[model samples]
Target: MATVAATSYVMYVILRRDLQTKLGWPLGAVCTQAAHAASASMWIFRNDPNTEAYTSNLDSMHKVTLGVDSEEEIKKVADKLTARNVDHKVWIEDGFPVCIALKPYPKEEVKNALKGLKLF
Candidate 1:
């Protein structure tokens, strides 16, 4: 299911490149995945491939952006993660969601652990 969801997400981006122009950024998938993980970890352990819940949350943020049109969206994402007890650092460039830095977590070590597990 995870693989299917990941694939669908990639395909969605591929099919929506034109739309992504205004709503695009480098590492958008990574950012979206991070967003999903952050939100899902907060609400519950949503392991389902169905994206209704996660996309709903993203839609809510998008709606809010329609009015504020500032850092509100990015801040809201970070705030949601923080409110849910997820320790993360966020960087927003030019009002778009940029890099999300997990606080105090050895990302390289985590990647190494995943590699050791042969998950990649």
Candidate 2:
């Protein structure tokens, strides 16, 4: 009998480039937004099996930060993920969408949904 290896899990963070370019937010501010989204997503999905597996091996946990051009782009991605039933959270501040974070999932399962996005 052969055994298959478990798929590695990862969290994906998406931020809007305009947060800095148009809003003139400092780099630290942008980073803070991403952090907030990531944290919220992890907490929201903490009970999920994949989140458990991903966090159990702290050294192996992975996160990828991607960028979008504007708020519209961010909402588009959020809608797409929702349509696909992907677990994620869109962080909003002052009534504006700041960024988004996807809960831990097999990289292959969510990579396609992020196609065309660039690293932040």
Candidate 3:
């Protein structure tokens, strides 16, 4: 029998819930916001050790998809993450911030700032 070291890294992909609930965006369109942010975050931090580790195991990548009620709420979370020095990307379309994606990191390192969000 063989054992592998435990990996606790994850990428947080947050979507603006209002886009679908209040603004009437299609599910596909809103999900695309999350996809764009996640992709950008991964690409931008491709060389980071945590990202490398997270991607190294393609069969076991971990991601948390969360939702914020409005633009203000989402931006607040982004600001909080920024204050904490967490790396993330705020996806923008037509100059409006649509979603946020954080670079892959140890779950314990980034979960606090995101504790309030609900799964999307």
Error of 2 at 59 (Å): 2.2
* Sort order, TM-score high to low: 2, 3, 1
Q: Please give, for residues 1-120, the per-residue lDDT of candidate 3 as tens digits.
A: 753322568888989889989999999999888999999999999998778878877888888899888888888988998999999999997688899999988888887888878998
Give lDDT for model 1: 0.34
Q: Residue 52 CA error for candidate 2 (Å)? A: 0.1
Q: Cα deviation in Å at residue 85, candidate 1?
A: 2.4
TM-score for each predicted model, relative to the true structure? 0.26, 0.92, 0.92
Off by over 4 Å in 3: 1-7
- Can you write out model 2's per-residue Cα lDDT over 1-120, one digit (the tens) per residue? 753223378799999999999999999999999999999999999999888878886777788899998989999999999999999999997798989999988889988898889998
* Sliding window of 10 residues with minimal summed lDDT for model 2: 1-10
TM-score of 2: 0.92
Cα RMSD of all models vs. native, in order, equals: 15.9, 2.1, 2.7
**Candidate number that wins on TM-score, 1 or 3:** 3
Candidate 1, superposed: residue stretches over 4 Å from native = 1-20, 23-72, 94-97, 103-120
Off by over 4 Å in 2: 1-7
